[model samples]
Target: MPAQNPTGLPFDDIRHLVATMPAADQAAGDMARARQGDLLKPPGALGRLEEIAIHLATWQGKGMPSADRPMVAVFAATHGIADRGVSPYPGAVTKQMVGAFTDGKAAVNQICSAFDAGLRVFDLALDLPTPDITQDAALDERACAATIAFGMQAIAGGADVLALGEMGIGNTTIAAALCHALYGGEAEDWVGAGTGSTGEVLDRKIAAVKEAIAFHGAALSDPLEALRRVGGREVAAIAGAILAARHERVPVILDGYVVTAAAAVLHAMDASALDHCLAGHVSAEKAHGRLLEKLKLKPVLDLGMRLGEGSGAAVALGVVKAAVACHRGMGTFSEAGVSDKA
Candidate 1:
């Protein structure tokens, strides 16, 4: 039996939850594959669309896949490392962007509206930035657990698909630190010019990541400890949301680099956490491709997009819905009065 806690702290026993996450239904996927063969088309003609439908069926635990209720949740928080000039934008931009999301003025808001998907933004804490991870822990255990609980609540009333996004001024720095810690790479390999930083700003960002990793490398082998030592609240919440979505058997669509970094944290914790997820798009961020390679996720779209806030995932939702429609609405050869090949 999966462990249950009545105190509402989902992250308190995350290992147990991950251990008990229901595996994707292979029978349903097999059935979906059989149905696809019966559809009136050359085998594999539809290519990845057919494959996506089958994958969705397995995660949804049904022969017919559906992405009817797509939800995009964006978590926003402040990072103390922003003071080190890791990004061109100021920390206040995090709150301002949250306001833009709430007012339906951000790019992600417009994308969600156009796609007819629901959007929710969580401001973890703009004014209360996490401690500078180069010198101290980013979040204590209690705060980390609480923030994770906050993200787990993102899927409301049984959303069919969840997309995770984040907004933090210096998150790329944290992401670089986290990736270096998990993957054992140099800072230059994972760091990038986030928010349009370049030249001296980008160099400083890289140096900052290098310094933080050197300071905390010993504790990083433990995923949760690494998150506490170097992750933003938004990053922690995104990880929590991914785990919660998997527990509920709802498929999750990962957005860009920072968001994928959160998924990386979950992947480090439990490899199965990725069974219920798909890469929505490949971001232009440098480390994004490596991250997807690490997760072994094939992206649904690629347009050189690096604008986070779930925009890429929201755009990719259309493709997911189309794939589901193709899976559920197409007619079999018998139903279409067409003869099957021997």
Candidate 2:
């Protein structure tokens, strides 16, 4: 493939970027592991917290990981499939919710405040929705690649960790369609009644995903093509953000089905592409757990959270904080004058 897409965005650049991403620091992870055993606690006493600290240390390339500058980035876009009534909320709600995030009125806002994480909400051409997937590709190759480039800038301001969340009404349908195309199952396997769609609306949602797969055909075999066809702008942006995070050695916390769809595209290309990401939660939205299985990622929480907007990711940030505090703040058995088993 050429290094550039039709719009002059470098598709080859994306491919090379994912392929050449930095590997985790094995030395740092080993050091962190040694410290975990030295901490004044019984073996495995801290469970996932111990593991979480090692994951951060490995990716951050430090013996002690820092959750001090955790940041939550929310990408908001409008999906053309939303016009099909796949979600109960109107398409305009995508923009409205972005406003709510900036105004500190959204559920994620309270969670971010609680966690003391910086919050940044990005609006990706909400006024110009992507083409409806059932009838046409969601975006042209150039537009898709450009949106991805824009997403790569998400972490430019820098944070030690990145938690991704998205808001795009009817995006659950887009997410389902992307999954069906990428993973190949019954459309119903990936479909979910997002925002309370059920009965007739749910049927329409499934049907739309089926139509999109049929329409895209062989093109879906290529992850980038699948992304440009059925995926939304936020999906493209999220993929870019994930790549950017990997290149910069920032661990990612992914929220909900839509955000995972973005990661799926990268994972399809390189299985290790999402190695830095942690599934923040198993969403109440159906098929989410199934998708996580496909990614081989164990989520950090399972609170039945179906609300999008980085809410789940924000909640998991608190867990990450606990892990960091335990890993870095505690004294080793020797330093604390505690005895270790011989």
Candidate 3:
């Protein structure tokens, strides 16, 4: 893994960038719609496939969209909350899985290889975990913003589309707290059996989330504050990567539950900030579908997957490529010498 470029920005700068995100290229989207109609298929016959093509066109600012350089950027980090018996696995598993990714043995690696997509793994100071959200702020304002700046580096490999995923033991607890803070739901609505927690372990996870939110209190009123207070390093980085993709006109595919928490932070800042992203899948994580619905993103797949390493997003990338291939490779009715019904 190449060293991440050094970047240290403040929250104000991140907020400003989010506030002024570029709108999608509507002209290109219109042209893509027209092109779809010209293809040898009935209008809307392809369903979400047609919509996906237009989505890429609009975000990529090109009528003929390309997924030739799809990339998956997976961020891995440790959470101090793991000390609270929130996750069945210890926090050390975060580092171990990151090694598997580097050795090309992880599920996401296989998925990216299957789709012919490039893969990048970011280890965000796995040795130095964020503070336990139930005990203290996960990160101060400066550290949170800096982590985001580092996350923006995921865009440097010239990928046209980015799929965001994360690995952090106990992060489900972190995400639950984030969602409860952002959406004002009871902690149970946001908590789930992450890492297969159940019985007493699940109860601790729920209590941890409720305690963290109550402790954070008025600080969570601002979205960024909410992120820094309860979010982990990988969460902040994913948020940065999504924002960078939007600025670069690169469409994004968001992976399951943990990844969506990052997007929720930005969406809280600006409702349209995630206009360039698509939900890669709805995971088996119980709250993932609820989170996706709140974000207004219809997923590309729903295979009961809960392994988080951007694997689902990588699989969804294949679907996106299929949509692009069908839209651009199929012959128009005129070229195919097909007759039209009056």
Clashes of each: 0, 0, 0
Can you give the TM-score per candidate against the true fold?
Answer: 0.96, 0.97, 0.96
* RMSD (CA, angstroms), candidate 3: 3.2
How would you encode candidate 1's per-residue C-alpha lDDT over 1-342 as one tens digit per residue? 255655565455766666677889999999999999999899998998998899888998898888889899999999999999888888889999898898889999888888789988988978899988888889987788777767898886678999888888999899989999999878999998778979999999998998898888688888888887899899989988998888787899999999999888888877878988999999889899998999899999999998889999999888888888888898889798998777
Among these predictions, the greatest lDDT belongs to: 3
lDDT tens readout by residue for model 3, 201-259: 99999999999998999889899999999999999999999988988899999999999
Name the candidate, 1 or 2, with the larger TM-score value.
2
10 residues in a row with least lDDT, candidate 2? 1-10
**Candidate achieving higher lDDT, 2 or 3:** 3
What ranges in model 3 sit over 4 Å off?
1-9
| Candidate 2 Cα deviation (angstroms), residue 327 | 0.4
lDDT tens digits by residue: candidate 2, 31-69:
999999999999899999999999999999999999989
RMSD of each: 1.9, 2.1, 3.2
Query: What's the distance in Å from true for residue 198, model 1?
Result: 0.7
Model 2 misplaced stretches (Cα beyond 4 Å)? 1-9
Ranked candidates, highest lDDT first: 3, 2, 1
